[model samples]
Target: MDRFESLAERRIREAMERGDFDDLPLAGQPLDFSDVDDPQWWIKRWMEREQIDTAALAPMVIQLRREADGFPDALRRFDREDDVRAYLEDYNHRVKQDRVESRFSRESRIIAPVVDVEVTVVRWRELG
Candidate 1:
């Protein structure tokens, strides 16, 4: 095993000296990933490339959290304060319902927190 390992290392060193790896793609560039936190990053990249709706595969709590994260941007579609309030109220209602169901279900352990409608309303007005 040691003999084979040394032979492989010597061949790699000889190749490097011969500039055999100089023209390889992204030879001097940094990798796209800056961290190793997400293990499913390759799957995500493939999904994006295929134009798949990756969100559909996520849990409901994750979906709600994603929606809540983009709530400010989604508010741009609403032209009226009443519409914003109603939308937020509906979202909060779903959060509450999911929280109750999650507690009773064995599969789901994470329950998304309800959005604060009045605070979100103020944010919506600010976005206008």
Candidate 2:
């Protein structure tokens, strides 16, 4: 450690002195942010920039929320009301489990609430 300069900072300073950053694209433009303290935050931003599917990286509740948004479509896979009801049961069971899991963590709970499968099934009928 030399004074307050970090290794990465020192390298960047040297590169600037050598004019290595002169010809870089968008070099003169201000960056929204270059440093993020949270690794998860950085990874999420990189995933977004790369157009990556980061559903696995998201919290269980967030994943559930996305699934819930498409729940009507999922029920469409079943031709019978009984099958639809069974699938809804399973989905709601998992949502309850996730809510319990959220209580065990001290970090921010991003878990969304469960959707009303009954109402969604009604909407599906209107669309049909």
Displacement of residue 115 (Cα, Å) in model 2 is 2.4
**Candidate 2 structure, TM-score to reference:** 0.52
- Error (Å) of candidate 2 at residue 3 is 46
lDDT of 1 by residue, 4-55 (tens): 5687798898899999998898789878874357898888788887999967
Candidate 2 ranges with C-alpha deviation above 4 Å: 1-53
Off by over 4 Å in 1: 1-51
lDDT winner among the candidates?
1
Q: In candidate 1, list every pair of residues with a backbone clash.
A: none
Residue-level lDDT of model 2, residues 12-125, one tens digit each, is: 999989998888888788876655666677777888899998677778888888888786876676777777777777888889998898898986877766667788778667
